[model samples]
Target: MTPETVMEIGVQTMEVTALLAAPLLLSALVVGLLIGMLQAATQINEMTLTFVPKLMVVALVLLFAGPALLETLLGFTIRLLEGIPELIG
Candidate 1:
């Protein structure tokens, strides 16, 4: 592949990765922030307090958004595979 083609593919890969990970990551971030705030307000500084909630929230996000995310991933994979021939040539 040409340099531009390689760069474009790299960018696309990063975008797909971010899209795939965003929901879970974002959910964890939100849960962590909320938990932190609650801890601060209550003076409950437990080191492991955020773990379970973050895990549960991420699991919920995956459950709800999993199918659509899979579809998106599948579409990207198909497109990338289909472009292999052009890249090789």
Candidate 2:
């Protein structure tokens, strides 16, 4: 593959990865921030307080977004695979 082709593939892969991961990561971030704020307000400094809620929120995000994420990844994979012949030639 040419250098440009390689860079294009890398960019596509990263875009797909970010799209698939954004939901859960964002959910976790929001939950963690909210939990932190609550802890601050209540003066309850628990080391492990955010873990369960963050996990649960991320799980919920995955449950909701899993199909879309899989479809996106599959589409990217199929496109990449289909381009292999052109890349090799």
Candidate 3:
């Protein structure tokens, strides 16, 4: 592949990576922020307090979103594979 094609693929890979991670990361971030707020309000300075909630939220997200995520990844893989001949040619 030409440099441009390589760069395009790299950029797409990054985008897909970010897209896949965004839901989990955002959920954790929101849970962390909410936990932080709750801790501040109650004056409970427990660091481990946020960990469980974030983990649970991420797990739930993955459980619910896993199929869609898999489909997305599968679609990308198929597209990349289909383009191989064009890339080689």
**Tens digits of per-residue lDDT for model 1, 1-89:** 79999999999999999999999999999999999999999999997999999999999999999999999999999999998999999
Tens-place lDDT digits, model 3, residues 10-38: 99999889889998999999999999999
**Candidate 2, run of 10 with poorest lDDT:** 13-22
Task: Assess candidate 3 and give its lDDT.
Answer: 0.94
| Tens digit per residue, CA lDDT, model 2, 1-89 | 78998898889888988898889889999999999999999999997899999988888888888999999998999998898899999
> Which RMSD values do the candidates have, in order?
0.8, 0.7, 0.8
Error of 1 at 53 (Å): 0.6
Let me know the TM-score candidate 3 reaches against the reference structure. 0.95
Which pairs clash in the backbone of model 3? Answer: none
Write down the lDDT of every candidate, Cα atoms only: 0.95, 0.90, 0.94
Candidate 1 stretches greater than 4 Å from native? none
